[model samples]
Target: MNKLRIGIFLGITAFAIGFAACSKSDSSANKPDPTENGFDKTAMLTNYADNLIIPAYTNLQTQLGVFETAVNSFMATPTFANQQALKTVFKDTYLKFEHVSVNQFGPAEAALYTNFTNTFPTDSAAIEGNITRGTYNLTANSTIGQQGFPALDYVLFSPFHLNDFSGPNAANRKKYVQDLVARLKTLTGNVLTGWQNTYRASFIGNTRSDSGSPIAFLINQFAFEMDQLKGPRIGWPFGKQSAGTMFPNNSEGFNAGISVALATENLVSLKAMFNGNGSGKGMSDYLIALKKDKLSSDVMTQFDKAINALKAVPDPYATAMSVNKTQIEAAYREIQILLTLIKTDVASATGVRITYQDTDGD
Candidate 1:
């Protein structure tokens, strides 16, 4: 969830703007087909599509179904008990989102899921503005910050923390919450449908490793998500960019204070996707075929380091940014190491040109 940027995907390049894979050389597909190395690109693609990408979206659909029903129950009852239930399912669904987030190339790009689904420290002013107005376009790009899981995090835990669902502005607040979940369900479900209906066959069929190939998109996004973990998810709130001044509230899921868990889950997703979610053919397998086994092994080792470091940080991450400063800094450093490995070392090894602009200059 980016803070400084709103329209951009923060880490991913402009594949969502158009058919960037066809014309752009730096985003998704940028490397020549490496089939000469006997890595079985088609098999890798099939494994990713069948085992990793599609399955992630499918699970997300299930969690979102649960989340929508939870919202329905809460809105119907508007009680403290129902509110807590909604919070539980919200975190579950948000965690599921971390998995699908890595596959933000084919159908996810078509849905602009990256652009809308996760931006935080959400626009509190904009969100309140929409709620008070009692009408706003949740689907519009202008409403991006107010449209995602982060926004729901705030709506669920912070603003209405005192079980105000049945109190002041009850109708408007309930309507806003309902609209947010509805938008999330519709947009995310459409992405899943796109994958199941058509994108799956094409993604597994095209084995070419061009500037627009699915392999490049997957690998590029792997690094992009890692970069995001290093910066927005960890560094920005830890004050890596602001002269050692902490903006702890900038933490993703700040209101719910699940920042550490979200960051840990993001790293876990990248590592899982990289290693084929445990057993399938992933980028590490391709690296092994190319005889870059050390790089492959180093990447996994660093993923462990990063995940462990992040998990070391206590919950309510914003508060920990001050109370647990040393632990937060250590986690940030490990995340930086992982980013360098994936974006630079691994990108070079895989033959994909990584391109995404950020002011942090890391």
Candidate 2:
């Protein structure tokens, strides 16, 4: 070959090799890390611990402090005005309880916090026996229904059934109320202390999505609480899940007639946790990162629908259950939809194995 032709061929070959090398380098640099492509489990856990869980428990603890004072005042006087003030504080504390109840792991699980704080459809007979005897153990599993918010609901609002707390049992009733509130205060303090002092670090640091990790426990508890909201809180009372038998008294806050209000607060808290409350990292963000946008949107939409439905039902949920059964049913349906999305789509996308037992066949 001529020198000029050889020089041109050599130049073209070198340029081609250099271009290929540059392209390969760019591709390597642009490739996403496998870990990054997977979920940032740490970010989600940190956001949850800081933004949702800690704040929720702290708020509950603060409210319970106020509630305890109110209880003490009411117990000292036991007048109608004092009773009204105590009821107001009790309702406030109960609403706050709704916000933190879904966090059923860490110290909460150890304390059986939910079972201790809000077991509903309280066994009136058991509660009465405890009050009459004045020697019952609050921590015993059999006393679950006789010592939580539900028991307070009975003593505070439905005292009329127990002879309006004006008969011989009045002092016993008051004592029982005091004991329940005091126990709640102590249990809540333990939970708050655990989170603030010890569990917070471990919760945020353990970022795996496996069964034993904080993330899995959170997801499972979240779903379990949603089921609680749908089934026992709404459906069972509406006769939709209890073989078409209306049992309005079975509702949460049934005596105080604020079941819908408490349910609304619970739903609000759940949505906040789902969205991470603008923390820039939540279950919704994690799902979206996993390309489960549809699932995330549907879950959020269902939450809004449920909240709106509950809002439509007037206050005094006991009366509303009879007069506004349709609205309550609608809210229950929306919650069920949300539960399905969380258990199936969100769980599948995130590889979170739900450890809670599902008996509702949903």
Candidate 3:
């Protein structure tokens, strides 16, 4: 071969080799390990811990503080004015609870934060029985229906239920309300401290996709939160789970007439968590990194569609549920479709195995 031809051929070979090496490095950087075309789990975890999780807990703690103050003020006089003020703050703080509800792992799981904080249509019967008897354990799991936001909903907004604070059973009723708020404060505060003090570092550092890793836990808990939104938050009260029995008051915050508001907030936070609280490092980013762009886009689109449908529902969801069942069911169907996308498509793309047991087979 001629000298010029040989020199050009060697240059081309070197250039090809260098380009191949660069491509491989780019793909490897996206992975959980040394494999090509993977994601940086640590970066995702760090984004979640720092941006999404901490901020959510801190905001919730701030709302909780305001809520506790409201409780104290109401206890001081138990006047109608105090009752109204307390109810306002109670609803705000309860809505804030949805922000941190999806993070039910590690400290939250240990705290049983969601179950303790928002279990609803709280058992008014159980709460009343506890107050009448002047005996109940606030911390016990079985007493969930007797405590939390729902119980407070009953205490503050149920039909003339708050009148007992000025009636013969005043002291007992007041004591029960005080204890319920205290339990919520303690459980929520502990989980926030857990995340802030040490769990943050632990979560960011352990960057595996295994069942116990941050990814697995986040995805699993995310699905669980969605299921809660679909089933307990809407379905049960809508009679989807009761053969169309239509228990409107069974909805969360129904006594306070804020069921739609709470459900909307819960879903808003879920979408934020799915998108990394707008930090640009959420599951959507992870999926996009894997070149699943269409899946990522579709999930987000569904989220928007669901949120819009939910917003279209009239307020006072409890009363509206009876006549507007069709509209509410339309919103519920949208939520269910979003749930399916996350469980099947998002879970499949991320490779995070969902460990939560599902009865509805989402």
lDDT of 2 by residue, 1-362 (tens): 12222222233233223333433444333322223356676777778888788888888888888887888777666677777777788889999998887787777777777777777777787777877877788988667667788888977778555344566777877777778888988998898899989988877766556655666676776787677777667776777655787777878898887888888898899899888886558888877877888888888888899889889999787688678878877888788888888887788887876655543557
In model 3, residue pairs whose N, Cα or C atoms come closer than 3 Å (at least 3 residues apart or on different chains), thus clashing, are 30-38, 30-39, 31-38, 31-39
Q: Candidate 1, after superposition: displacement of residue 69 in Å?
A: 1.5
Q: Is candidate 1 or candidate 2 better by TM-score?
A: 1
Tens digits of per-residue lDDT for model 3, 1-362: 12222222233233223333433444334334412256776777788888888888898888888888888888888888888788789889988888887786768766666667766667777778898999988887677556788888888778877677889998998888888877887888899899989888777876556556667677766776677667767776677766887777777787778888888998898899888877557888888888999999999999998888888888798777867878888888999998988887788887876656643445
lDDT of 3: 0.75
Clash count of each predicted structure: 3, 0, 4
CA lDDT scores, all candidates in order: 0.78, 0.74, 0.75
Q: Which ten residues in a row have the lowest lDDT in candidate 3?
A: 1-10
Model 3 stretches with alpha carbons more than 4 Å out: 1-38
lDDT of 1 by residue, 75-176 (tens): 888777777677778888888888987887777876678678886668878888887889898778778778788788878788545465777877888889
The reply for model 2, stretches above 4 Å from the true place, is 1-39, 159-166
- Top-TM-score candidate index: 1
